[model samples]
Target: MSVTKTSPTTNTDASLLADHEVESTYRSVNNVQLHIVTAGDPDAPLVILLHGHPDFWYGWRDQISPLVEAGFRVVVPDQRGCNLSEAPDGVDAYRLSELSADVCELIHSEGQESAHVIGHDFGGFVAWNVALRQPSIVDRLGILNVPHPTVYRDTLKSSPQQIARSWYVWFYQVPKLPEWMLRRNGMDNMVASLEVTSNSGTFDEETIERYRAAWQHTGVHPRINWYRGFRRSGSPSRNTVTQPTLICWGTEDIALLPSMAEKSVDYCENGQLRMFPNASHWVHHEREEVTEELLRHLSQNSLS
Candidate 1:
């Protein structure tokens, strides 16, 4: 991993969302400084947006305005190792427990005892752990396009189709080569990954370039290290998610099967799954209805 410090440029055009108040700042958590960009009123109920792999806080661009307009404070962070956040070395530093702790401290640092958590892809994986390991700090949970870790582990072992789709997870486990390939061709692969997996025309050229610039930032290796740590962490315990959970999945997701979404609800004491048949892995972007549905779910389960 490159140790050089480089900050990615953000799309500062307010017209991207229109009339939204955005603040970019850093917070010290778990010995690492995390870049947090917040929208909406701080006095409103807190809603933390956790983006998936190969994405930073900007991934929540679409949802931020609607969520804020719905009378909730939206906090999006560059999740420790992505974009401007501190990227600590070593596989142990990227462990799920440590990642969850960063989030726990984030809520406390923001002057909230708990906050509503919404996550997509790998971010969904972290949200699950947060609810399980620190239920008190997560008032409600929203997951997009990623299965519960328990169900995912079992599915990976039993489902051939899922295992086939997840071939990259294994590939990412390889030392150095995956990083080299990711950075090759000026991060064309990273841009392609988003374009191919998302609905047609979901990502414009500018959007793709923004993601490429983020990957160019130093310490992106920890993004891949997340998969490595998961591979080494072995199986997760059979823990029931006690929070009111909403699992919104794109049925057309190529990486994860729809069955995993249904199975995820079984582990939650209180969970609901919303499916989007036409959408792919990037459901939040492909379907605008996602933000509205999420607002309803988040509002319904609010502890405030």
Candidate 2:
């Protein structure tokens, strides 16, 4: 399908994205139409940014303009079941393999065989699995605040502390309740989850409201299905990731432990880990250091 042209900005988000030349489009990938935001020169090298749960393409507002100025065309997509993207029925539709395939087909639809892939949180899970399942199509890999599946699965089963920190995961497993609970009071619960989980004041009033609005589009069920699918699917078979990968983690994350960052690297044949002690799960927003590191990593990879 040819890319559909639309404006990426909303009244609330426009002020934040005012300076960037952002374009919104819908691309048919993996039998679903995903809302994608693109910036920079079409002829430039492609860098795909994937956002995690409870976010849409706007989640990369901080990084999008910077990456574009760095000379790479950026593609930020609202993955399956999030924001303007099509939400297919059933948990099976949201599995890791299917999620990665959506990315695979997205790149193909963009007239590129490969791209520099970066993902945060759940998007990191998709990014990791994409590189594992289709290494040839991924030129470089970057993951933030998400562990390698092998390490995370083990931690969830064996580490009581991790299980405790991830109590929401278990809570989200019950059908429909999490969705209902999060949507209450204009998504006050969802907004609070982002605010309290991050470093104090990382999410300003405008940011929180914008996120809440984004979540309202696809609603709670599709957003939570990623967890439900993951829980049902179990650990993936592929254990080793040979891609030159960069994992950036914030130490103060309330959900994922810092040790999981180190263990995530062990799964990669060529990987590096950078930790931000003062930052929370929302590292990219908490500090500019991770953005600088990401640019450096991408530049190095491009030269290699």
Candidate 3:
């Protein structure tokens, strides 16, 4: 990633009917029609959720039901180039700045003036920009297992171990091979990784199939484009994250450690940290109950 201090963040949530998420669609920063899975009352306070790389809104499955029950209107989008979301053909459309706009449009389209935003992994990355770019549109923020962009850059520079953990990112920088590997060995590896890496094993054959089906789409280039955008994106560095925020880290995450997570509060004017000592990268899934608690705490910060 290039080094810089600037950028911003999309939305609706559509889910499979088995769980009864409402079917909806929204346009992204790129103006592509995208589907979203949403639950809760539109009239209630809004909480829009986002998922990260190699994942979709399903990543928030455990928390969604609980959060909705807790009385927050939750919106979880597939995000640009993921699952039901639009995948613009060219890589240029997948840049971070553009990705940030997707978030903005979703909020603009929501008709609500503001929302509590939550994101995991890449979603967390986008969450930062969304909250930053449109502070008035966001009420609060919750981020799981993703450091601020700049802190992540420091990890790559200062720690060889962190670099090693991020080897997949290097592989993803390639043109087509990463997708090919994922299409083959990558899926099973991801499933296996989920079983051991998270505090609880949420991955099963059925879940993997859903993910696979999403990946089997024609516009996978945009998915790879996110990694490609990293090269063009400014070098990740720590900067002010002004949103009232909560950062959650899975302690056992092979790719990240507590030290990097600790750096988040430096930029955050108002921030809190929650760590899952036994959970890996998928901290929310590993410690579902605790994740729900933090999400509730952050989302309800402005409640009447």
Steric clashes per prediction: 0, 0, 18
Worst 10 residues of 1 by lDDT: 11-20
Q: Arrange candidates by lDDT, highest first: which order?
A: 1, 2, 3
Tens-digit lDDT string for candidate 3 (117-185): 888888888888777766777788888888888788877899988888878778878878766665566
- What is residue 211's positional error in candidate 1, in angstroms? 0.9
lDDT of 2 by residue, 1-304 (tens): 1222233344323344777588787898888888888889988889999999776777788998889989899998888887677888788888888899999998888899999999998999999889988888998899999999888889999999999999988998998889889978988888888878887888888777677666756677877889888877645557888878999999999989999999999999999999999889888888898899889889886676
As for candidate 2, its clashing pairs are none
- Range of the 10 consecutive residues with the lowest summed lDDT in candidate 3: 1-10
lDDT of 1 by residue, 2-80 (tens): 3446555654222335554777888998888888888887888899999888888889988988898888998888887
| Per-model TM-score on C-alpha atoms | 0.94, 0.93, 0.86
Cα error, candidate 2, residue 17 (Å): 1.3
Q: Whole-model Cα lDDT per candidate? A: 0.84, 0.84, 0.71
Kindly provide the TM-score of model 2 when superposed on the true structure, using C-alpha atoms.
0.93
Error of 2 at 101 (Å): 0.7
Better of 1 and 3 by TM-score: 1
Question: What does the lDDT read for residue 177 in candidate 3?
Answer: 79
Give candidate 2 regions above 4 Å deviation. Answer: 1-16
